[model samples]
Target: MNRKTLVLPAVVGLLAPVLAACGGSDSGSGGDDGAIVVGTTDRFTATKDAPAPFDPAYSYDVGTWNVLRQTVQTLMIQPKGDGDPVPEAAQSCGFTDSGNERYACKLRDGLKFSNGDPVTAEDVKFSIDRARSIKADSGVFALLSTIDTVETQGDNEVIFHLKTADATFPFKLSTPVAGIVNPADYDKGKLREGFAIDGSGPYTLKTETDGDAVTKAVFTKNPEYKGVLDVKNEKVDMVSFEDADAMGAALDKGDIDVMTRTMTPEQIKKLSDAAGGNKESLVELAGLEIRYLAFNTSAPTVKTKAVRQAMAQVINRSELVSAVYGTQAEPLYSLVPASVTGHSNSFFNTYGDPDPAKAKALLKEADVSTPVKLTLNYTTDHYGAATKQEFEQLQKQLNASGLFDVTIKGTPWETFVPAERKGQYEVYGMGWFPDFPDADNFLAPFLDKDNFLKSPYKNGDIIDDLIPQSRRVADRLTAAKSLTKIQDIVAQDVPVIPLWQGKQYVASSDDITGTAYVLNSSASLQLWELSRGVSG
Candidate 1:
């Protein structure tokens, strides 16, 4: 738990080639004192029922973690490219037992948070124990569930005892869930309520808020920090936009140095067309983010495998990607995206291009009548404005086939999340941004018995055998065979239908340096990597 340098995986290598050219510059304005300005539509909002989004115990989304990665130091940090986590707060960390259950890390000699409090083993223990004990619904309790107990060894070292062998435990420590906070600034049982942040990261953050919404977060380089990251910029101003159009416009008008997160397909196309003027302005990186549909297996409508498989056969991914997303995304054929270590196009292999004939044949074979009824649900506000168009396109495709009756419904994200979680929807939409960069992260969350999807998707081979087997291997690539088998099983069962894979695009004013480094394969932005300068 104590901040220490731990090893990470080689997931970065998967995207490094595409990101190699992101560091160059062309022409654009720079912030004062070499500071950087960033625009994003990703809002970190806190609700009355949920804890403060800034608190590590409560913050579960990618947007909040993007900011937290800059201000709050984890025990280990994932470096920019192809390697394990280097020592930031901790000097060294690794599994101490052959079973991979006992992990330990020794803190650096003189590590301190922004508050000047010494980073110690006890603080690490308190942080982990408090997070596990709170178990807030909004918190990442699932990620920390593997830890059986935390014990401190002297003032500089901390040890973790796990319930089972988990080779992915080290990667978990590199996430914001394992972010080490100052014990004094946080309570043992409650979430941190205010905007004030104290941590051992490379920068210190101050926020500008309107009511509960954060408008901007100003990050100043922490002079009293010690970490593996090289602080490239003296200051960073992260500005939040209500929508992607405004954010895109800000980048065009030079109001912001960089634009990221959610941009409309139209805006992306515009930028992509304009990229010929200055190619470096549009920085594209290999992304692991994906969008898919989750079917409630227990629901009366989509419960049968024949119905789900037929729908899968009828849903044309190529058309969906072209009409809805344009060139913004690619058709994803598997639960595990192509960027991950072990990815197979099991769905594509089973059912080729959209075949209404095959779909009708499937239904006939199963003794089901034509024009089967199905309600496709999607969120109107959460993912992006394009979501509405995406589902409408799906409805068109399904209805055009004349093989089924499909009704497309749209709901606000606030209501959609709870409704889907409670299994109120027969078939609903979901998007995944990985908690870590690995094949296990892509599979375990949905295939497990107690999955986040809340769908009745339980496979004994996947949940009990394949998943556990995959996690036991330290080398992630070696576990690809097992991961492929798990994907094959899910494809056959048709619990979830893979839709499209997303690519990370950050449009920066040509003057911005390190735009490529701003986001990793996991799609988490490291603000410290952004600096004001002309690219080569």
Candidate 2:
């Protein structure tokens, strides 16, 4: 796709308030320049710090890998603003009728990795095999478990032979986990020892400073990139901050052009009000994210179906959304948020409002004693400001039911991720930004047995039969129906209770143009489509 540039005039008007909420301000003028500045809380501080060996094969968490994956091209990529898979590194792909067990991908000719290495069928084979071998924290490999073997068919073609039938196999190929990389950059058999990222995405990491530890990630246009990227700016500057409040303060001072995961509704409103008074300065995007509560079924107390169900019933979703998030978030009941397809109100239909008496009675019937005390943990910097308050409300609601005792704890994302993966906490609050824009993306990660959660939930019928059975059908509606059934089962079992769907909120300087927002499951910013504007 041809690149598009948006230019907003610096004219003063009512647009300022919206711009202010979006992190734009009308201050002593700096004219439209070719650069875009982005502010975010916390940089991915993985042990390996170099950008050359930044292969997705060893990536588990989304923060660092996502930046790398976007820079490096994958075999396939999710379409912009949608969940459907489209071409990326590969030209085209489809399944062979070998009973839906064999899949083939055709790569675009002359495609090259950032290092000038030719992207080949052999590279595809190496990437897939390496991902499975390392089996990093990424859950994408689980989708490949069905693959029997990967063989290069020709210079531009590769085939995946599956041990069982699977139609969703192509979708798996589109995920960031399956991103293509150069085998020459690192040992294909072993994980990279240091922080080096090398791939064929839209950008490259140029310099990383260790003192204040600022990661200066820059995206250079890929000359060999033949995919559908409409990048406008020549380069994107991603600035990492240690604190959300500090990031918000920076945005207010015009030190940052874009701020992620920092602004509160009150703060956004203040910016919007400022923009309204002065036309050339601010922009605001409301409700652009999602957050939820996850139950560690491996925990003894949470393992009991009745206890899980009681906890779900006792949650006051509306109150939680209103009190903690204000108007920035809406009440959510399904694993699939309202913005996506196949979203349902199954949870609301089953359990309406908080009823402590009913919750207590359910626990009693399950032969569980009252005052069920459990510790709840959450990441300190990952979600947002409202996360702690949201969990606190949950503790209060549950405790008020007199059915359980609740304690709350918080940690940073880097520590919380591994701890939760090891099933360290009894219960924890977690948030999922979609890997892809499909309902399947939300359900598969949490419910899939090999996921990072490593949930002990074993529904042979769902995993072994229903899910795989649904994949064979190419129709999304039919696949959605099967997924809906799975959601119902999860709801009844309460492995993870539905919390609230967060709104994507953004503030941009009025001088920046061509910055149309495209919502996705990943919640990633499409830097390619952003550009400096002529006026407000």
Candidate 3:
């Protein structure tokens, strides 16, 4: 539920810093000759919601985590297969108890921060505790909410005491939220103030800013990095842009080696439409980012179950994706997207297709009158400019049915986030970039009592029973029944309507290699994988 504005590539919690320098790269300075300048619209501003943008405790968006995952080393890394997490900073980690409530890990030998500080068990404990203590409203603290306490066995070992069994705990540890930081530089109580990153990951990040806006983030391969990743590039430069237009232009002009996260739908169409030879430059990965409309179930216009169900039945997801997102997204039938392991086509199986007759039948059966006035709220900045087009299309579809008289409203990301949290909108749009690859990461965050939506969706059966039961099994595939049931329950309740799932697109120069390797299954970007000097 890392909500980001359009052009803001919503990552879990990886982000760079805000500083000042000129935007984009100089023309004729790209290609196989120099550092791979990857262009993006992701900004790492230190705001009220994200006061500590670089600190693992505060940052919780994909844009931020994209950078954090490069600079900070986590206890474990996401496995390439469906098996449990593999070792990174930790030599190994697993449940030490039969109940799965106790977990322990031993740090790898010769682990050190980029600053030469020893990566000790105390540092690991401090990092986790600091994140929990700060617990920023926008932070990933909710992911770490299960931790009861932390205890160190020695300099190399750390143990976590959980309140209950959590099978997803290892997956959570693979996220950037558990990114270990050097205790000497990072204060336990507050966010470290600076654009500089001091961690032991594959890259050591340094930002060049023009005033407060970060123009470029320079990632140098960390010689001291001791992790599962094999650093491929010597240096990779991330150039920031204000919009897709500028970023796309930079890519076309060869001012940048690669452009990712957000190219406009039109830009994506142009590249995808490119004939024969030009197609080699565009790289696409299976993405987990999902866009959906969350019902303020307590709101008057959509308070009834029938009203929400009718709205869901009437939404044509295929039309919405094709009309607005083009090749960039696909129609999604479940909150847990199809790219995820436990995803189920519950909505498609339940609603079948967009049927105005059925929608009308629902309204009539509920004894509800015609032209039910509803306001569709969305953010102008988050999710891209296409969001407005999407909502307008939604408005058109609902109004044409003669059942809903819909008014669309738009706000900036700044106001939308807090307002959504307060349940100020009847039905607002939101995007979720996974905190981990599991389906639990998608279902639990929106359905829990401490859900990001803050809607009246506290279902005891789903939360108290299904979610906990799902989390008790470490093999994610084994928990599919519970996850599928949760999605079915969500579809029945109609608290949220799954709209579209995004595809990760990376447009790079023909000379750039390893663009496909940049993103993991969870869509976390590994900048080190991108290298220069490849033939077209």
Candidate 4:
């Protein structure tokens, strides 16, 4: 596909007063042409700081992507203004055949890594093959299973043979998961090591106090770098913090030039409560994040669709947004977030506004007893500190309705992901960060025969008919038309209840310019868009 402007949902423009008021004051905000220090409370690692902890092949976190995206070049890249996947390292990329199973790309000429190594098609093939071979926990191996083989015609050309038609393949190329790495420097069998990265991009990373999250990280313009982006800053510094409070404190003190995701909901409210500081500094994105409860459909407890729909009907999403998340999120009626092309309010239209009487009546009709016992699971450390309260509110909403014997279970994220995947929970919460911006990412992974939701409920029509048709369409609008039906299908089966969708927020100081344009469609941070103004 050729480069085009990304489509954003109208809801982003129509957010509630709380969120709408928080952003929009800082477009074209000026910054000095100098080094800018970016701070975050989130844990961060350079691609090679402690032996490439943030390597694209092994990374799955926002913080790592925030840094690597500036340095690592992908075949296709998601442009910030328009989240469309545009060519980056490659001159152009698209389907090679009508089957949509074959994909091809030609490399841009004169491309070289910071280390001055020529980037070739063999390296591209190696990088793609290596990501799947390593199969790291955070790797993109699962998504590339459709690729039967990859072949390189010459130094500039690489072609992919897909086992099945996958329309979303181009979007995947925009991610670090498909990041083009140097074959000479990286071992495909073992994860790349050390603070040395052979990257061909706008910036080159060099840590001031390496291996220490609390220290500073520096990214300087790569003189050898060749790409489509213009390097605006002379240098960029990154400071790590433990939580929003700590980062917010530093921002208040003007110790950092820019900060992203720095304020908690309580702190954000305090911006008005205290009525001081750079209020216009906040920027909220129309991001693609969906938080939901994955039901163990095969389990006898939630085996029936009536119980799933009953739970879906009773668990109030508005309350979760207003009370628990505040302006941090909006209620999502569809698994596919509204920010994407093919999103629908199938849940809201199908079952209007959380009706407890109707939910109880439905449960009774299904022969299920009162107070259907269920374990609602979540993680404390993985998502953030706020998730605990969010899950607590869910437990309250369900139990208070007198329809559910809700047990709220909390576990660390590291432990929870595997256990939840093993089908250990009757019902568990799952937050999805998209593999690609496409709406298909929202549905296919959850509904497929072997989905990320291990004990997933199967719908043959979705697996067999809707998704295949959606994936084969090359045009996004055409694909979206097919994908629109997915929400209704999921609502009918109700394997998972779409609870809420979140926005990407960056809380930079008033003078920091790129705060308003930090996120792409896939919700990856675009640090390249950032630049600093002269310190006042």
User: Of 2 and 4, which scores higher on lDDT?
Assistant: 4
lDDT of 4 by residue, 1-536 (tens): 11111123434323222221222333222223346767665565443223455677766656566677878888987665554577889998998788989899999999998888999999899998998788765434666767889899989999999988987888778777787888877887988754455588788887655443326667888887776776766777777666677777776676775666535777655543443334335555667777898888888889988999898888889988898778668899999887677888988988899899999999999999978888888976555668778888988988988998888888865467567766788888878878676787888778776465665577777888888888887776788766878788888779889989876666655555555565654556666667654222
> What are the per-residue Cα lDDT tens digits for candidate 1 across 1-536?
01111112224564354232233454445455555788888775656655377888867767888888888888887777634666667889999999899999999989988978888999888888888888766537677777999999899999999988888888788888788899888999999875677788888999998977789888999988887788887888888888898987777676788888887878776666652444336666667889999999998777778989998999999989998887668999998888678999999999988899999888889888778888999987667889989999988988898987899899966567668877789988888888877888888878775466766778888877898888888888998989999999988999999999887777776666676778777788888777765434
What TM-score does prediction 2 earn? 0.88
Summarize candidate 3's per-residue lDDT along 1-536 as a digit string, tens digits: 11111122333232312211112222225635477788888765654544567778877778888889889999998743223577899999999998899999999999999978789999999999998897766637888888999999879999999988998899889888799998888888888755767898989988888865578888888989887887878888888887788988887777887888777788776776665433126655657889999998888888899999999999998888888887678899999978567889999999998999999999899999988999999987656668899999999999989999999999976567778877789898888888777789899888886676667878999978999899888777899999999999988999999999987777776656666657654667878777655232
Candidate achieving the largest TM-score: 1
Root-mean-square deviation of Cα positions for candidate 1 versus the true structure, in angstroms: 5.4
Per-residue error for 536 in candidate 3, Å, reads: 7.7
Q: lDDT for each of the candidates? A: 0.79, 0.67, 0.80, 0.72
**Clashing residue pair totals per candidate (backbone < 3 A):** 7, 57, 25, 10
Off by over 4 Å in 3: 1-28, 31-33, 79-84, 192-196, 210-212, 276-280
CA shift at 230, candidate 3, in angstroms? 1.4
Model 4: CA > 4 A from native: 1-35, 44-53, 137-139, 193-198, 206-217, 272-280, 298-300, 534-536
When superposed on Cα atoms, how far off is each prediction in RMSD? 5.4, 5.6, 6.4, 6.0
